[model samples]
Target chain A: MRAYLLARLGWAVPIVIAILIINFLIIHLVPGDPIQALVGDFPTPPGYAEQIRKEYGLDQPLLTQLWLYLVNLAGGNLGFSFANRQPVLPLILDRARFTLLLMLPALTCAAVLGVVLALAAAPRAGSLYDSSVTAISLIGFSVPIFWLGQILIIAFAIKLRWLPAQGMISLRETLTGWAAVADVLWHLVLPGFSVTIYYIAVVARVARASVLDALSQDFVLTAKAKGLSGRYVLWRHVLPNALIPVATVIGYNFGYSLTGAILVETVFAWPGIGNLFIASIGNRDYPVLQGIFLLTAVAVVLANVVTDMLYAVLDPRVRGSYGKNA
Target chain B: MAVQPGNILEIDALSVTYRVRGKTVRAMNAASLTVRDGEAVGLVGESGSGKSTLARVSLGLIPRKIARIESGRILIAGRDATRFSETEWESLRGDPVAMVFQDPLTYLNPVMRVGPQIAESVRRHTPELPLDQRVEELLELVKLPSVVTRAYPHELSGGMRQRALLAVALGCRPRLLIADEPTTALDVTTQAEILALLKDLRRRLGMAMLLISHDLGIVASACERIYVMYAGHTIEWGGAGAVFQTPAHPYTVGLLRAAHAVRNAEGRFATIAGDPPNLAELPPGCPFVPRCSHALAECSRDMPERFDARSGDPHSVRCWLYEKPGLGFDRAGTG
Candidate 1:
């Protein structure tokens, strides 16, 4: 297992480097002038753009700029945001915590609810409950995240007056300790649920199909024949086997959720990395954009590696195959 | 083998139908058979002949929504199993009766260690016993090494996996073990080994067994009584020796001939002329009438009832030739 992890890390290094290079090239290639976006609606003094370009090292050739960027990146400096005039790494790190706080619970909820709903629907597939779940999941999957977010805010925050709608917490009132935590949670619900709904649908459908497949397998029949109750058989035999594909789907969906968080955070005005990303894009803050992209790439790669390792742990066949390779 | 009072399993006119796309397909038509205590009964048939269906029904493992019991009764250990609820079936399974499926790989949970899989059965039936000890004992009973308990299903050879499955089947110390094509997926050598292990287990444990298979040779070697099925009907049944020596039904005769042809490495093996009947569109009379060479005109018009093939023996055949005395003599001469 250690050897497998080490080998995976060895492969990850080159892939991360490749991703960094591509991300830098794509940002540079895009039609945008960070200096001009920064100086928007201002009468530029003669040579002002040139002075700003020279100040940020954007005056250098493309290759020279990429090389310097790599050198600065390797030296643990994410450079300065052209718009915010702050170090990009610290800015991302501060906002990233909020994104994690929101996303982790949302993803976990989606996964658990999806599997539970799927399990309930699988045995009675084609029945009213199954069809209803299928229909609901389809709607959840098709509905846009921003639209869903607005609808949730209207329903819960405006009309019902049950929960707070915008931002991370109540700006009007002072809160501390558990009250502060509760306030944050109250605000999280709408955006968190909105972002999670689509994933819940993806996971639920996968869980349903996988569980149904597992139910049809001969081992489930054997488990049933062993005098185990249907519930026991489902819990022990069906769920574990069915969870493999579901876990893989969740891992891949992590990257998707990051992108989705941007749209949802914009709608809800949640102070997370997603909201920062949108602000950076509008400002043409290349450093911050580059930082967010790199972090997201690293997160996606780490998720995939963890998922592969988890597969090995969950399935002995996968473990054995790895052992043979080792 | 006489009709005994203390039969471990009894299916009385049990008919099962599968609902496929709004059409009811009769999978088993009033099939009835028994396995007395400590007796080994082999049910032999071609594919789709309802052999496996019979096995599944005996254990009440058939899917409820898809397959329905049209009419009849299933009595396990003289307890009417026809109306057994899910909880009742759960209690009955792995204790009074247990099953070993055809494909060993499929029967064993791939992700689970062999020990835990067997231990699960032990825990279900005998929760008082220490799990590790019971698992070790069951593994020993199947002649598998102690270390084998820690291995996954995929780690073991086909024979070892089958033995592990047997250990699981015996975990509850069931009164009857239903082996549905237990050796079908094994190689020639492993098949013999599994059969030998099953025979030994049956002897030592004194557990009645219902061994379902398509191989005549396998059934002949392992079982005392043999039931021959064709298309969804129990066409002929008797002591294994008697059934092999004098197959009364043409389908049974064809099976035996095919078995012999394979044994002798003949250039061309004998085969039943047509496909098994489609249950959805079954003819009014006999299911085997289309393929039976000795089928008479009335055979296609009326279903044949089970009749004694010998005066004093318990052997029986479901054929028009066997039912009419004069016709039986003439058919016997032709053979």
Candidate 2:
């Protein structure tokens, strides 16, 4: 456990550093001036433009700006948004829960549904189930998320009246507790389902392919010969091996899903980091953009770190295989 | 109720065909045999010799993706298994007959602990027991120290895994056990130990077995009767004692000679000529004719029937050499 933890910590160092570098570069090198935005038409006004720039530390050297950003970042002060003057951390925290609440369940649902479909389709590779799933996934992969979201909104929300078309639940409703929680879930259906469809499609395809490969392995045959039920053979023998390939995609997809969640959020006008990110990018809000990007990079790295720890937990060969190889 | 010393499992006209290269390949063709209670019947053959197919078909573990049983009767305890539903097959598994596959490592689920895996099989048979007791009993049955069950497949040695598989197979108190090359993957010492353990288990449980292996010495030492298969055909069948003492079929003789223990290095390998015929493009007559040293024009033109090898019961060869046909010993088309 200690070794695993240490290894994860070691892997995180480079990612954390890369995020710092990329965050600084993206925020620093961008056109237009935050100082100018802060004080409109102050540019070319001698001593006036200089004063606002000095006040915001925009007059500071590139290295100094980076140093300030890094120091404040370590201390949990993500600086203030240039356009809104709101603390970046507060803005992010206010929106983070909503994004997580939406994405977490969507992710879980996608994973479970994908696994079920994949397992069902595994035994019938190239048959109707396989072709149908493959075709569905192809359509899914090709669909523009914004278009898909709009289609869902029209079908489920406007035409059918099965769901609320827009707006997250109010704070007052959520504060009323568990009943409000149920209300949020009911409201969550459209956006969640919209996000999940893509995940389900991709994960299902991956899982089906992996399990098909696993079934052809000698070990799966060995498990069947042990008199294990076909279900047992699938759940115990095939799925575990299948999940190895699945785990790899899960780590990478966490990033893809997190960033991609923005497009859906924008379509539904849902309040998430993605929506916040798009708003930031449109206005060229430097602090908010930097904060969200940094957080996302960190989240992806963290997901990978956790996945690394799960390696030893899932596969003993991975746990000790490298040691033998070394 | 003790098992009477006869007829435990029967395979009648068991034929398994697989599609290969846009053509149907007969993996096993009209293969018939029986393993009597408390007896060991060795299905001996080289790779792709229908031996493994017979084992799988009899167990209902056929690979439905490619392989299909054309027409056959696999009767476990005089009951036709072809008609069993999935649920019925599940209920019958590990209870009436249990199968242990070739590779030991592949037998145990890598993700599962040894004890729990065995306990699962045990619980399948007797699901009412406390899990702890069931686990302990399985560990004892397999003769492993109880602590070994806590270990995963990667943790246990290959031999230990085999023993655990044996325990799982024995869990339901099966009337018959099918072991397909139990010791093939193990080292010499481990192989001997597994062989001995299997022999002991058979004697103690009085469970009949269809021991599927290509190794003649292993069969000669462990099994009582041996059924020799070639290109999906059972070319020779008889008691192991009689077959080894006087191998009837040329393929059987070649296999016996090919075995490392029977033929020492100084004596050059008496390899059978030509490759075993591809079942898809098998010769018009006997499947083994392409490789048989005794093959004649008649052998290629017509299939042979079972005939006496040494004028004894329980010893038969499917070769015209022993029949009152147009050919006699050291002669061409003249008896």
Candidate 3:
């Protein structure tokens, strides 16, 4: 197990670096100049743009700039955002917390709701409840996340007025401690739910299929014959067997939601990295974009590694295979 | 004669039907059998002969949605259990009755350690006992090493896995144990060992057993009495030696011939002609009539009820040939 963990962490290094390189190349490839975006659209003094460009080391050759970027990354310096003129690390870090606040609850709720509904539906697979669960999941899966977010805002925020339509909190409130947390959570409802729907559908669909499969396995018959209650059999024999695939979906979606938050954040105007990411693209702030992309890549890699570890934990066969390979 | 102390189980005219696609197909048609206290009974049949269905239904283990018991009585120790609720059945299971299924690898939870799988039943039935010690005792009872308790199903060999499954069944100390094709999934050599172990456990533990098998040889070695089923009906039943030596029903004869043909490799391998009738569209007569070589005109017109095939003996058969004394088809060892 120790060796497996070490091997996974070792593989994560090159993958994150590769993603960083791609992010750098892609940011540079876009057909716009950061200097022009940073300055006004009107013509600048001839040497003025050159002075600002040299100040940020942008006047260096492409390869030299790439080399300097890698060197700075190695030294843990993310440089400055072109638009904010602030350290990119602190700027992205400040927004990351808000994004996490939105995502963690959404992911947790999605996983719990998915597995619970799947367990309820699997035993009565042909019943109306099963069909309804399948149909709702299908609808949730097909609807676009941004569109769903808008629809939720319209219904809950505008029409019924049950929730705040946008933002992470009621900015006017001078709340603190518990009140502050409650206010933030209250404002988080629409966006968090919007983010949750798609993942809930994905996880439920996968979990339901696996649960049905687990129900039909021979061990399930053995469990039933043991006089265990249907609930006990489901919880002990069926759920554990079904969860490996559900965990895969949950982990993959959890990682993807880091970047996936863009639509939800934009729709709700939540002050997260997703909002920063969008604004950075318009301002052609390469450093901020690259930092967010690099962070997302590292997070995705970490989620996948954690998912692999979870697989070993859930299945003894997988754990044994990993031990042998290690 | 005084009534025997109530057979461990008495399945009377048990009929089960499965809803397939849109049609209800009868899986077990008035099948019946009994397992006396401490007696090992064999239920022999071809595929789709409802052997497994009988075993599963006896334990109330069949899923209610896929299959339903159309009519019958399942008497457990003289009490009618046909109307027993799920909760009542649950209590009865793993205490009065427990089952060992066909394939251990599939029947044993792959992710669960051997120790816990066995202990699940043990804990429920004997919560007063120390769980660890009981688990160790079960593993030892099945002739497995104590270290095997830590391993998962896939880690064990086929023979060892089946033993672990047996241990799971034995953990409950059930009075009546049902083993449905228990050795069907094992290799030939392993098959003998598992069967021997099952017989040894039955003898030592004094549990009544209902052994279901498609192979006549496996059942004969481990069981004292045999019940023969063809397509859903229990066509013949008697002492194992009587049924094997002077099998009355043509289907039973065919099964014995098939078993003997395999052993006698020098002779041409004999196989029963024609497939078993489909339960969905069975003819209004004996199901075996279409395949029986000695089928009479009357056999195609009506299904015969059980009749005495041997005088002063318990042997019985569901065949028209046994209705009269001078039927030439009653000759033994024709196969």
- Top of the candidates by TM-score: 1
What's the lDDT for all of these models? 0.87, 0.78, 0.88
Off by over 4 Å in 1: A324-326, B1-4, B262-267, B326-335
lDDT score, candidate 2, position B177? 91
lDDT of 1 by residue, A208-230 (tens): 99999999999998898899999
lDDT by residue (tens digit), candidate 2, A22-135: 778867677877666666763375688787678778788888988898899999999888776789999987887788888888888888888888998887888987899889
By lDDT, the candidates rank as 3, 1, 2
- TM-scores, all candidates, are 0.96, 0.91, 0.94
For model 3, the superposed segments whose C-alpha errors exceed 4 Å read A151-162, A173-175, A324-326, B1-5, B262-267, B330-335
Clashes of 1: 0
> Can you list the residue pairs that collide in candidate 2?
none
Please tell me which model should have the higher lDDT, number 1 or number 3. Answer: 3
Residue-level lDDT tens digits of model 1 in B31-87: 889899999999999899999899998888988889999898898887888988878
- Local accuracy of candidate 2 as per-residue lDDT tens digits, B174-224: 888999988888889998998888888889778888888878889889988
For candidate 2 chain A, which ten residues in a row score worst on lDDT?
Answer: A317-326
DockQ scores for all the models shown?
A: 0.86, 0.52, 0.77
- lDDT per residue for candidate 3 within B1-335, as digits (tens), equals 12247498998888999998998888888888989999999999989999988998888887788888889888887777887888888878887889999988999998999889998988888989999999898888889999988899988999999999998988888999999999999999999999999899899999999999999989988989999998889999998888887888888887787877743445667777788888998787789987888888888897677888783468888898888876558544444
